[model samples]
Target: MAVAIVRNVRPWGGAAADVVIDGTRIREVRPASPAAAGTDGESVDGRGLLALPGFVNAHAHVDKSWWGRPWVPYGGEPTTQGRIAHERAERGPLGLPSVDGATAVLREFLRHGTTATRTHVDVDLGVGLRGIEVVREAVDRLDGAVDVEIVAFPQDGVMRRPGVLDLLDAAAAAGAASIGGLDPAGIDRDPVAQLDGLFAIAERRGVGLDIHLHDRGELGAFQFELIIDRTLRAGLQGRVTISHGFALGELPEPRRLELLDRFAEAGISWATVAPPATAPLPWREMAARGIGIGLGTDGIRDLWSPFGDGDMLGIALGFARLHGARTDGDLTAAVALASAQASPFVHRDLHDLAAGAPADLVLLDAENVPDALVRGPRRALVIAGGRVVARDGDVLL
Candidate 1:
């Protein structure tokens, strides 16, 4: 039975059409049939709003946020190690990594039209997979309205922290889609050992690796090579991602091009939050080389920093402004990176406003894709898995 019909909407700013949903997938999308729209189980008149696939948050830290609580001042130091220590010291007292906190962050995501996300949950000696459990319970609390993929992340140094590798392995065995590493050389000071340990676990457990590489310039590039080598060695191609690889943009053109080729060869993908003042990525070249790029909001209102709101469109806009996107094509590409192009990041084979795709979409009152990308107006409605989960910027679920 058809669950719903979204009437008279412009998909990607195309001609008006009615999107029919059956079960959890789109059944069909054909020319607008206003008369037939009245027969739907749940009929939503789109009012010719511009429709887009539900936003995909490729990289996030849902477990770390303290949303829905009173504002906590940023008390962590500026450096990564300092922030990690601060979080470990302070999170316990604040009841961090609770289901409520994670749920709060996810609800904010849904309210902003994000239907799916790939979030990294901290897996350190202190937390000991408790964060993962919190995130899982939060997802269950939502009852599948938001699809979440977990990456058991070693936010603290993987190699330096004893027993963390075993925890990561345990997480992989317990159904974590991917295991994460953080700054192998900068934090662990042993890039080779850290990468080798992570690769060994990934190969053994048949899981993917999403490593955070914050070491800038040559140091970062060196680790990238090490990761590339290990990715091919372990036959983990197409299952490895480098998150916040700031070095890629900092390198000279030739060096950057060389690494891009190697990254393509290793089937490595990238996830970034597009922080300001950083070098702009060679996104055109990466796109040409078929390298996948995923955008994320990182962490929001956490012990790390008191920023972000879990809005993927705002992150897309930040990416556009950072990359100097001015033309219609570039602007639309930015939005696509936040939606359809990010499908792979969330393990979706396809995610768009078309037949056979998951019935997850957002409707905004805008003229076109570029307009939506630039302004990022409030979502008029959000359909997730054929159900109206949010409307008029309010999360129904």
Candidate 2:
């Protein structure tokens, strides 16, 4: 029964209040009380800070991020296939002796106010379950500091590599929270079979689906339909997620509206790394339609591109800047894309800094929500599970 009090903080950049925590759950949220000063629990002074629900990163690749390694110029890849080839050629040989790289990035994520993330660990014929094993090990090591949802990601198309399903099954059995897939039409060349295989595994294993659907335009819409049909049939609805469904945003206005209706109906969600594109994602429309859309860093300084620093605040700002969000309302919504808006998609019981909720939160040196969004201030304190895990940009846990 460890008790703690976060005093004088503006929750969601609102009016100042004191959040009282009893062990792992928030006990109370009320105006500053003079009596709280004499309470026996630990007290974290939050003056001049804006408190927010800890950000949730819905899509990530933690196992093989080339984040801490020496810089390697991205090998030129004219097409998606070329990029796949370059990635396999470059990443296959990066031996894994320790979980140092992944741990380092997870620490950085905590320092930047992200307390939980869903990381896709590669599961393919080449690497088998080695990547998943190392990532799980890291998760175990950092259990209390950051919560991680492991996705057994078939980065090298499931059907393209024989016996990959068996490896994925093994990884899931070993404790992967979900199963993942690459581009069905573009990489596997068989959207129906690939989706069937992915959904079949998810159903059989009693897990969830987080497919990487990067196919563009009409082809992407075709794949999305197939996914929706399968999700509806299997009754997986809210349990299914489509990462990087960028093509849906590229469709004509009428078509996009129709499909968005279908997405809301099926309860399917979308996760984006907030990549800059010629045609922007219809995030505002999606939000209006009650669709669940979350943000992620995708690959943190990985072979894909030389970007990402595990800073969700910086990425939230990117989401705002990319979408031309200048008004206060727009900026607040952008920040929520990485926080409350994203958390429920991953786990319905998570997010929000309310009583009875887990005390997973961040206190930033900002006056309000809009200020936090525009400036991307450093975290003054990051509390996960009612414990101060990181303070002043240093990971105490």
Candidate 3:
């Protein structure tokens, strides 16, 4: 049976139409009918607002954020290793990875019109698999208002910490969508051993690998090559992703182009948080070569840093500003990278406001995609899985 009808909405700033929903999928989109508008509870009047697919957060850290809790001052060092030490020492006392913390952050994501996400949950020896469990319970608490794909992340060193591989394997076997790795060469100090171990586990468990490569310059480029070679060897093409690969934009032109070609051949994808200080990515070149790029809000108010707000629109704007997006087409593309173009990151074949796609969408009172990306006004309505989940910046579920 049809759940609801969103009447008189302009999809992607196009012609006004009526979007019909049935259960968890979009039934159809047809020309608006004057007689179809009703005050009944089964229909929602869109008021000709701009409708877009609900945002997809390609990369996120949802487990450790202390949102909705009393303010915890940022006392960690600036470097990567320093932050890791600080989190390990501080998280235990704060009761980090609790269901309440994860639920609060997820609610924020939903209130910002994000309907789905690919979140990295911590899986170290201290917490073991407890963090993953907390995140699962948090998602359930929302009654499926937000869809989350889990990545069992070894935030600490993987090779240096023995028995972590077994934990990752257990996570994969227990139905985690993918496994994550941190700076292998920089943190573990043994690039080959770390990469080989992660690849081995991914291959054996039939899961994907999403590694965090924070090593910059030639060191980072070298690790990229290793990942490409290993991906091809393990037949894991299209199943591997590199998060925060800051070196691709810093390499020399010739070397960078060469690596981009190889990356395309190996089906490697890139996820970035679009920090202001980093070099602009060669997004045009990567797009020409058919490489996928997805944007994310890394971590919000977490032990790592006191930044981010779980808003995908803000991340899209940062990406546009970083890449110097000016024209209308480029701005629209930037918005796409945050919504429709991010399907593969969350293992979705299709996530849009069209027929046969999941009925996940956001309605904003803006002129078009460019206006929405620039202003990022409160979402007038948010529908997930053919159900109304949020209204006017408030989460209903």
Q: Relative to the true structure, how large is the alpha-carbon lDDT of every model? A: 0.92, 0.82, 0.92
Stretches of candidate 3 off by over 4 Å are none
Instruction: After the best TM-score superposition of candidate 2, give how far the Cα of residue 240 lies from its true spot, in angstroms.
Output: 0.9
What are the per-residue Cα lDDT tens digits for candidate 1 across 251-340?
A: 999999999999999999999999998889999999999999999999999999899888898999999999999999999999999999
For every candidate in turn, the CA RMSD to the true structure comes to 1.3, 2.0, 1.2
Residue pairs in collision within model 3: none
- What value of lDDT does candidate 2 attain over all alpha carbons? 0.82
Q: Name the candidate, 1 or 2, with the larger TM-score value.
A: 1
Tens digits of per-residue lDDT, candidate 2, 181-231, equal 889999999988889988888888888899998889999999989999999
Off by over 4 Å in 1: 36-40
Backbone clashes per model, in order? 0, 0, 0
In model 2, the clashing pairs are none
